[model samples]
Every structure is written in C-alpha cells, then in structure tokens.
Target chain A: MDRTIRVLVGKPGLDGHDRGAKVIARSFRDAGMEVIYSGLHRTPEELARMAVEEDVDVVACSILSGAHNTLLPRVVECLKKEKGTEELDVLVLAGGIIPAEDVEFLKANGVDEVFGPGTNTQDIVEYTKTNLKR
Target chain B: MFSGYPGGMVLYLHNQIIQGLCERKRAGLARAVTLVENGSEHARHILEEAYRLRGHSKVIGITGSPGVGKSTLVDSLIGAIRERGDSVGVIAVDPSSPFTGGAILGDRVRVRSRTTDNEVFFRSLASRGYLGGLSRHTGDIITLFDAFGFDYVLVETVGTGQSEVDIMRYAHSVLVVMAPGLGDDIQAIKAGILEIGDVFCVNKADHPDADRAVAVLEAMLGLNRQWQWKPPVVKTVASQGKGVVELLGKIDEHLEFLKQNGLLEERVSRSYIAALEDNIRRDTVDRILTEARLDGTLDLVLTQLSQGKTYPAAVAKQLIGKYLCAEESDNQ
Candidate 1:
C-alpha cells in the first residue's frame, strides 16, 4: 500500500505557545497530509523517536522560546543517528520567532526551512509538499 | 463448552448478529448501533466486522445553533429521501456533560417512532465534552453505516462554535442550518462555519424577519465567493417541513453538480488523504511518547522550564541528543 506521508509536528522545550503549531497543523490537514502534533513542550529526543517509529516523512518543530539555535541541531543529529542507515528519509523544519540570519545558519546544520510569524499557511503547505519523497 | 478466551461467547454472538447486518438485515444494524453508542466492547468488534463489509454511502453533516430546528428540518427531509427510494442513515449528536461524560440524546424520540420503516436508519451520538463539540466516535459510526450500503448518511450536531465546523472535513456536503433571529449568532460563528459550508439553510423562514436574515446571508455569500467552492443559501421552515422537499432537491442538484464538475471526487480523495496522514502521524507520535520513555521526562522538563530553572533551547538540544541520537553512539 502506498502510505500517506506522515509528519510529526512538535513544540519542543518550554514554549507554551501552541497557536502557531495548531494553525500549521490545520494547514497541513487542509493540504491533505496526516499531522501528528506532539502537543506542547515535547523534547527533541521524544520528537526524533516519534519520527522514526511513526515512519514520518517530515518532522516540523515550532519553537518560540528563542531556542531554534539550541534545538535544531540536536533534532537533526537524532534523525541521522537513529534513522540514517534505513535512509528513512526524514526532513527537519522549524518555524516561529526565527531571525533571518539564523535561517541560513540553521539550514546549514540540517534545518530545511525556518518560518517566522505571519508566514502564510500556504507557504508552509508548499514547503512540506516540496520536501516529501515523490 | 466455553471457548478458552474470556468473552468468547459474546464475541461469537456479536459475530452472528453482525453477519446478519452484512446481509442487509435492519434488526442487526439497529441493535449493533445501539450497542456501540453505549460503548460496549462486543459492539466494537461487531462494528469493526461490519465496517469491513460496508461501502458507498455519502455522509452529510448538518450543524447549527440550538433552536435552529435542525431535527425538524432533517425529519422533514427524511421523507423526501424516502420518496426517492434511497435508504437513509441519520446520526444526531447531542450535548453531554464535560465532567461526567454523560449525555441525554432526546432527538431520537422524534426519529425512533419511524423505525419500523426500513428505508430510514436513525442513530443519535452523545458529544460528551469532546473538544470539537461532536462525539469522538461519530466518524467511526458513520463509517459503519457507509459499509452497510446506505445511500446517504446524515450527521446532526449541537453547534458549539469553531470546532463543530471541523465536521465539514468528514462530509461530502456540509449544511450549516441557520434561523431568522440568529444573524448575530452567524456573525459570532462566521470565522469558522462560514468558510466550510457547501450549502447554507435559514430555517424557521416563517418568522417575521426571515427575509432580512436571508438578505444578510446573501450579502455574506457575496463576500465569500472568492474560494474554489462557493456555498449557496436556502431558506426553510423546518418545524412544519416547509421547504424540506426543495432542500432535498437542492442537495440532489448540488450532488449532481459536484459529481459532474469533478468537485466530489476531488473532495473525497483529498479528505481521504488528509485522514490517512493524520492517523499515521497520531500513531507515530503515540509510539514515540510511550515507548521512548519521553512521557516520563516530559513533566519534569515542563516543571523546570516553567520554574525558570532551565533554558528551553538548551533543554531541547539535550532531549534530541540523549533520546533520539543515543542509538548512534557517536552522537551521544
């Protein structure tokens, strides 16, 4: 059976803010993908294990506590170490409170994309589609 | 002699009953639905078996503010559908207590008396304080009916604002029932319900200001036609069954239009994809949270972060490193 692309949407760390995560989840739903939100305050390890177990094609983490720099690298490392040999094909993305310069820096260290506040939901949906395995 | 497994007789009996349901038996389907709605474990197994056999029912969801006469409106339309020789399945969702998870499904009183008629199947669901203001299990029940070969399945919900609007995702066509006095209520819900409806109904059209409400809806539609799908508005006095025939006609018309225009196929395929993805995601996340032991540490992390004792950024990095990448050995 050709499985649908599964995505894990997690708000890692102390970010109590979930409105953005929810909107993003809805956007994905509207775009016809399954989104599992890790609810609020998921640890990066928790998200990584979930991605592997759920066999998700993508892991999109939303962070607003100014933790993109600290959290992004660890998420990437987790995906590579635990799931790499299988070539499980995971794409890591981040959104919320990200500065412009950090986008490039995070992308260099394995973050595929960074969306700031006020980013249209359409853009997020497009990004997800583009990143999924054909 | 009893089977070795516990509850074996119950399962065996339920299977016999559900087998009759698969053969298009009404007694079995009705009894099965009642059992599931009551949350019986045996009913679940029967429903699962029945679901595998049923297919090809168009599920329609109708929701609106209380007193909009949704039940009366649906009751009237049921006759029209029956006249057309199509078997109909109706599921009405009513409010239940958020605390005790208790509900009173009173609308069944109106629908049950007509049970002797094989053309109609009526079932009511208890919303039971689910976040979306509809029963969590309502979708599954609809699926069971779909498998049973009903031509159309109707889901009625007690309106509770934005979340109830989510029902449109599960419907081939969504009818947002409104009344004459509820323009302000419409304004309140416009954010959620307005965008999703395929057809809008102004029930209680016999009232003095019915036209005024219709006019308001017309203006609302004028602003909303920018989407790929533009919903149409209809007026009805549901209590008296006035306009119900016309309403059914409109539904048929829309169904034809949607099918010919290719909108129906697009909608069903899109919703199916979305639902499939959601299920995978939910199952995946649950596995990680449960098996990776993240659930145990999650509370402590939250407490520390909330108390300002830990930096969220640093904590996030550590989580991915320890739990996610530790298997790699090098990363750890």
Candidate 2:
C-alpha cells in the first residue's frame, strides 16, 4: 500500500535527448512517485497508450528536439482518441526548452501545464501533485 | 445523499466494478488491478466476481537473471504472437527501491513497439517488497488480465536467484532466459531453476559463447531423467528478433505437452490455491495487526518481547489467542 501518485516520464518522437526526461523521471522518484520512463524516441500515440495502460495520473514529456508544438498536443489528442475525451482523466504536461511565446499555445491545445527551461524540478513535481485528479 | 446508507453504497460500487469487468473494458481491468494490489476493502468482491471469468488466457512466465534481455525477448514474442492474430497482456515487474520505495520501470520502455497496438495491453508493477520476485498481487492481477480476455498473459518477473520460483504456481509455462558469457553462474542456480523451466532460451546467440551456454544447459538437462518433457534449449538473438518465432513455436509445443499430459489443470489448481492462501494470510494477519494497533495490544506485546519475558513464538500465540479466536467466534 505504498502506492503514491504514478507518473509516466516520456520521450516523444525523434528526440534522442532524454537527459531532461530522465532528470525529471529521477526527480519524480525522489518526490516519492512511481515513474515509468518511456525511453527515447516514442511516438505520441505510444505515449498516450502507455499513459492509459499504466493508469497513471500524470504523463509528462520533454521536447528539447523542438517538436513540442506538434508532439505535445498530439499525445493529448491520441489519449483522447484511445480512451475517449471524456474518459481520459490524465494531466498532460510538457517541458524541456519550449519557447516562452509558445507555452500558452501548448496549454491551450490540451497540454495541462508547460514548463520551459530554467524551471525548478521541484515546482514541476509540485504542479503534478497538486493538479493530478486521479 | 447515499452516504446515509452504507451497505447500499457498497453494493452499488460492487455492481459497477463487476459490470466494467464483464464488458472487457481496459479501464475496468486497470481499476480492478489497482484495487487488488492495494488490498482495498472491495478487493475480495472483485476477485470473486473475476474468478469465474478466467480460464481463457494462458499465463506464461518469462524469468531470468537481470541483464539477460528478457524484455527484448518478450517484445519479440509479442510481435510473433500478434502475427498469428492473438492479443497479449504483459505484466513487467521491477524492484522497488529500498530507500525511496519508488521504481523506474525501465522494462516496459524496451517494448515500445507494442504500445499503441490495440492487441497488446502492458502493465508495470513494483515488487512491493515481496521477496518472491513478483508483486504480491501478481496472481490477482493476472486473474484480472485473464478475465479481460487476452489470449496470452505474459508475466515478466524481476528475475531469479533461487527464491523466485513462486512464479511456477501462477504461470502455465515458464521461459528461463539465459545468455552467453554468464560463466558458471547458471550452474550455481541449477537446483532452484532446473525444475521450473519449460523452455530454456539462450539469447544473444550471435555471440561466440552462445554455443557453450546451450551445451551447458543441454548437458544439465541430460543429467535429469525424471522430466516427462525434457525442456528444449533454443538459441536466440533477441535484439535482432532472430529465433523468436521459433521460440514462440517451442512455447506452444510445451503448452501442448502440458495439456496432453493433464498438467495444465494441475497448474491452474496450483495458481488458485496460491492465490487463496495469499488472500487468507492477508485477511487474517492484517486484521490481527490492525486490531492490535487499535486495542494497544501490539505495543504491550512488543514491550513483553523486548523485555525477553516472552519468546517471539509465544508472543504471536498470545496475540492470536486474544484477538483471533474471539474474532472467529464473533463472525460465526
């Protein structure tokens, strides 16, 4: 019964830079959450599918490869498609070098929260802990 | 408003949970698994509802020492199974960090190919301090997957040293994975692992030491004349997806061998008995511990044991005599 909040730390698409994703994954673990690290180069559909299968409260990914505009929203869209928009109760967040101007765009397109560079890992963890409804 | 009627509310929740399970809903299965893993108050009702819906999926256990490519082999096997038009459910168990009580389940990441495939359902589990090498609820969760109607329910454990053989009671057949250059390490575990394997797979077969590993396994098997079905040692390079199809075929052959000899029924019986025993222990011991805590007897017993006035066995006896016997009679 030591189950705390479960989170999926994903690396979506041709992003070989998993350093940020891994760092957040470790941070989440340190924050006492069970993390499932979906390793490098996963498609958006795969991440969404993993989110549903894992029954995780949060699905957070890093997009340092500059594909956040398409990849982040697509992950949300895919989860909606697979689990139904109304039934999918997951918080989709993105981080890792997202530009300041486009942060609002990502959130508007179903990204629950967006964390860019120079953000604190603890802040991200706290955001997930507070925001996740599951 | 319904909180005023407690029994009615529980009944309502029970029906809702059971209905979700019968509809073959993934969310339903996931929820039931969570309930069972946490040993929630609703867990028994869910299992009772699910137990009758089993017997369709073949629970196959894939186990080996760590770093032996078990995940890659499972991924390859998933592809081979799906090629023939069957769905698979995977349960990958990893170790819980002793310090943090959290785990980074990296095994599921390797099987990324099957993630979006509608036919493959993947779940990651932490061992939860169950030294038996799998989650304590692994059997119950397997029941949920089986009830959900997958053709193959594949369970990948945290690998074995010796005590990890509990998987045999849950899985219909076990695939013991090995690789090249493990030296005499396999020899060291011979007594514990030799009896549990139905199929021995030597992964990394492209390596030069592959043949030697296979020979060692086969020679070990040769020394055992008691096996009705002599386990076959198959070679595979799991990363390249080589020999995986053949490996699946070998597993199927073992499945047939088990069925023809009526061992499959025995396996199922053993699985249920194991599940029942675990549930009984949880219900009995957990209730005793909870009642002791509530009644302040737990501290009293600890004080007596620490003072060395009573041995450990006698202390356990006293607690059971006080709380357990009375509770049993009250239930009757």
Candidate 3:
C-alpha cells in the first residue's frame, strides 16, 4: 500500500509559542506530508494520544516552556506504552528553544533528534523524508 | 511505564491498522481513514476485514450551503447526542481549492469543545476533486467509524451543491440546512434539494426572515403530498445553541417512526446497496475502461465515432462481447 508520510506536530506543556509549530506544520503540508498539529498547552498524555491516533511517522514535539526534561520523556513513554507493532513506528523529535546542553539528555531519553533554533524547515523536511520507515 | 510498543518496527501497516481498529484504537482509526481517503491499497483490506464489525451505528448526514451553520448545528447536535449518553463520531467534508487542492479543514476546530472528550471522534476530509461535495471515500470512512463502535456517526457534506445531496444516500437521517436571507437561486434549487431531506433545518434563526424561510420550506413540502414521513422543520440558532435539543428530539421521533414503520432496515439496506453498487461499478466498468484505454480499444472507438462510422452503443457491445463473453467461454 502506498502511503504518504504522516507527522504530528505537538506543543507539550504551557508553551504558548505556537508560531514555530504552526510554521513547521505548513512546511510539512507543503512537503506533501499529512500533518496533525496538536495545538498549544498539550500535556504529554494528550500529545501521546494524538500521536497514536494520527499514526504519524514522526511526532515533532516542540517545547519552548523549558519543561522539556519533564515532559518530552513522558511523551515518549506514553507513546511507547500505547502504540502497537501494527501502527506506524513513531519517531519522536524535539524542537523550539531547547537549550544546547539539554539535547543529549533528551536523546538519551528516546528523542530521535533535537532541532535547536536556526535549523531550517527544509532540513527537517529532508530529514523526515529520508528517515520515514516506508 | 513503557506500555506503547515502541513506534519503530516493521509493522504490516495493513495488519497494524485493522488490529488497532479491532481494538478500537483512535490512532488506527485515524490512519486507516487517511489510507482510504488517498485510495491506498490497504484501504480495501481494512474495509473488507472491518465490514462485519459495522452496522451497529446510526449515520446522520448534515448538509447545506457554505455559511449555513451546518457545522455549528452539528457541534450542537454532538452535545445533544452526548447528553443522551451515546458516543459520537463526526465526518466533516470540506472543499479543496480547485487551484491548489488545499482545504482548510477547520470544522473540527469549530467543534473544539468536544475535541478532548473521549466520547467524541472528529475527522475532516477534503473533497479532493469530488464534485458532489462529499469525498468519494466518505462511505468507507463511515464503515470504519461504525466498526469503531460509535453509537452515532454524523457526516457533514461539503456545503451546498446538488451533488452533495448524493451523500444523503448513505445516511439514516439527513438534515438539509438553510438559513434566512438566501438568494433566489438557492430557493429555485430547493426543488431539487428538497427531495432528499429527512428533516429540514432553518439555522441562524436569529436572522430576520427566519420564519419566512421556514414558511417557504413548509410551503414547498406541502407541494409534495407523497411523503410517507413529512420531514420536520426545525429552527436553530446554532451559534447560540438554541433549539438543538428540539432538533435532536425530532430526530428521535423520526427514528422511532422509521422503526415502527419498519423503514429503519430499509434505510440500512439502501446504504448497503449504494456501497455494493459503487463497488460493482469500480470492479467492472472502471477496470474495463482502464483496460480499454491501455489496449487502444478506447482510441479506436473514439476515432470511429469521430468519423461517423460507428457509435458508442455498438462499440460498447463489441468490447463487452470481446472481453466478457470470451472470458466466460474460456472458463467453460
């Protein structure tokens, strides 16, 4: 079955800055990916639930609220708990105002990649296209 | 704590999808819908496997022209349905831009109050070139939604187009929405549109002339004396959530009427026949057309017709005889 890449762009925690998430969502839309933007102030549980329901190839969880350490891992854990082998192998990635020092910690907790500020949407789109497990 | 099977692994996307559907997983339902909407092969498998799991849900079709408050009415209706303690699944179809094929499916956003509720499932489908204002995949998605165990599945059509009325073929109850201050063209088109409504709603009832619009609808219904069930006219200020409960009550009365008259099964059979006939066309005529194009038979026919040497009826007979009858003979 032919499938387009599906991604869930989520903002977990109280970060009201949805500009970056919305921008990435538009980029993904332009790139022909089916993107479900799980708008602002989403908790880890909500993000996980939406990610599974969307069966997204990637969950690009964006956090600008500095709660990445507490929330991102929870999103990853919730995803790991609810999804089955029959669903898309969701890849979790983080973006938006994530401090440089926190990148490795997030990666250690199962975030596939981290996009600090200045990373172009094209780069993420390229990464997504190449990395999607068809 | 790690309950979600890690997302990465070679999952038979088809098996993975239907399994989630069987388990009633929201993610599975959502993904399978997209697969079907895009005409993916997995869609067929999912729908086929999931068919037996359907039929328990009632389908309600909501339709009207753009800005007629269909979405708002649906939002209110979902609340009303939930108040009666049943789960609801909504399918809202929006028009894709003719130029870009992009649509802002913000209907789900308008119904945002129900988004976080576990009892409500919302899906938006872009018409994606379907002239009828309902997606071609609408039927298949309804089947999946039914299988997922929603007690009531609501389908909202792509605004007001004559073809949008085609969607009524799949619903147990169809609400034709109209609002006050519509242009004369809409009134004229009502002759064609009025035939399909199980119930009529004049939404945005706060507007001036709301009663006049309702009177006009009542007058139109009066012109047709043959309706076994006279469609009820419900007035609703959808934005303010007025009269939504009364509309739901009307729906109950209609459903009860259908049940008492044994027409409930008839509506279900009507939808089944529609789905069956669609498949028959897809499997037979569509495939044959494709083959004819590929094998030059269509071009030959076109050339023949252009020269006035032959016509479509004769050519169709020849092709059918060549392919269908020959296949039958070969099997014998």
**Interface Cα RMSD for all candidates?**
18.4, 1.7, 3.3
Candidate 2, residues B1-332: lDDT per residue as tens digits?
A: 22332477776876666777898767667777877877787777788777888989988999998889999999999999999999999999988777777778888767857677878899998887787778889999998899888999999999667558888889999999988888674573457765689999999999999988988888888887898999999999898999999999999999999899999999999998998887788677988899999989899989988898888888888888887777455542
Error at A91, model 2, angstroms: 1.5
TM-score of chain B of each: 0.79, 0.91, 0.87
Model 2 clash count equals: 0
Q: After superposing candidate 2, which stretches have Cα over 4 Å from the reference?
A: A1-3, B1-17, B185-189, B329-332
Q: TM-score for model 1? A: 0.59
Top-DockQ candidate index: 2
Prediction 2 TM-score vs. true:
0.93
lDDT ranking, best first: 2, 3, 1
Across all candidates, what is each one's fraction of true contacts kept?
A: 0.00, 0.67, 0.16
After TM-score superposition, what is the CA distance of residue B25 in candidate 3 from its true location, in Å? 3.9
lDDT of each: 0.69, 0.85, 0.79
- Candidate 3, residue B274: CA error in Å? 1.4
Clashing pairs in model 1? A34-B277, A34-B278, A45-B319, A45-B320, B54-B147, B55-B147
- All candidates: CA RMSD (Å): 23.5, 3.0, 5.6
Model 1 lDDT at residue B21: 69
Interface RMSD of 1: 18.4
